[model samples]
Target: MAIGGVTIFATLGYFALYSNKKPEASAKDVAKVTAGVAKPGNTRPR
Candidate 1:
């Protein structure tokens, strides 16, 4: 019983440390993707 509890705790700890829920993205990146401002070889100040 004790070993089982320890294994469960270790698994939880590993998941808590390694899991990535939200990715990092800047506002500009999001905005650019949302608005069809420019395509390849095109640049615009928005």
Candidate 2:
């Protein structure tokens, strides 16, 4: 039971660390795509 509890805490800690690191490249890509589609040429939101 003690080992299982430690494993769960370790897993949670790993995810906590992972979530803190945001992907800046993906954000830039999304902004580029949004800017392109938001232009007057493309009125429909995809």
Candidate 3:
């Protein structure tokens, strides 16, 4: 039971830390980040 709880906590913690806060982006936004350029709404990956 302790191990199961720890596993669940770890999974949730990882997602909270590394999950993409942006679920959707405009084409212009996608283009900028991958091209190593910055657009108005593009954010670098955390």
**Better model by lDDT: candidate 1 vs candidate 3:** 3
For model 1, how does the per-residue alpha-carbon lDDT over 1-46 read when each residue is reduced to its tens digit?
A: 9999988876665455335222453444444443545364333233
Query: lDDT tens digits, residues 1-46, model 3?
Result: 9999988876665455345446564544554554556655466433
Local distance difference test, per candidate? 0.48, 0.49, 0.56
TM-score, candidate 2, is: 0.46
The deviation in Å at residue 23 for candidate 3 is 13
For all predicted structures, in order, the TM-scores are: 0.41, 0.46, 0.41
Query: What shift in Å separates residue 34 of candidate 3 from its native position after superposition?
Result: 25
Q: Candidate 1 — which pairs collide?
A: none
- Report the number of clashing residue pairs per model: 0, 0, 0
In the order shown, what is each candidate's alpha-carbon RMSD?
Answer: 14.2, 13.2, 10.0
Q: Per-residue CA lDDT of candidate 2, range 1-46, in tens?
A: 9999988876665555445544542433344443444353333233
Model 2, which residues run further than 4 Å from truth? Answer: 22-46
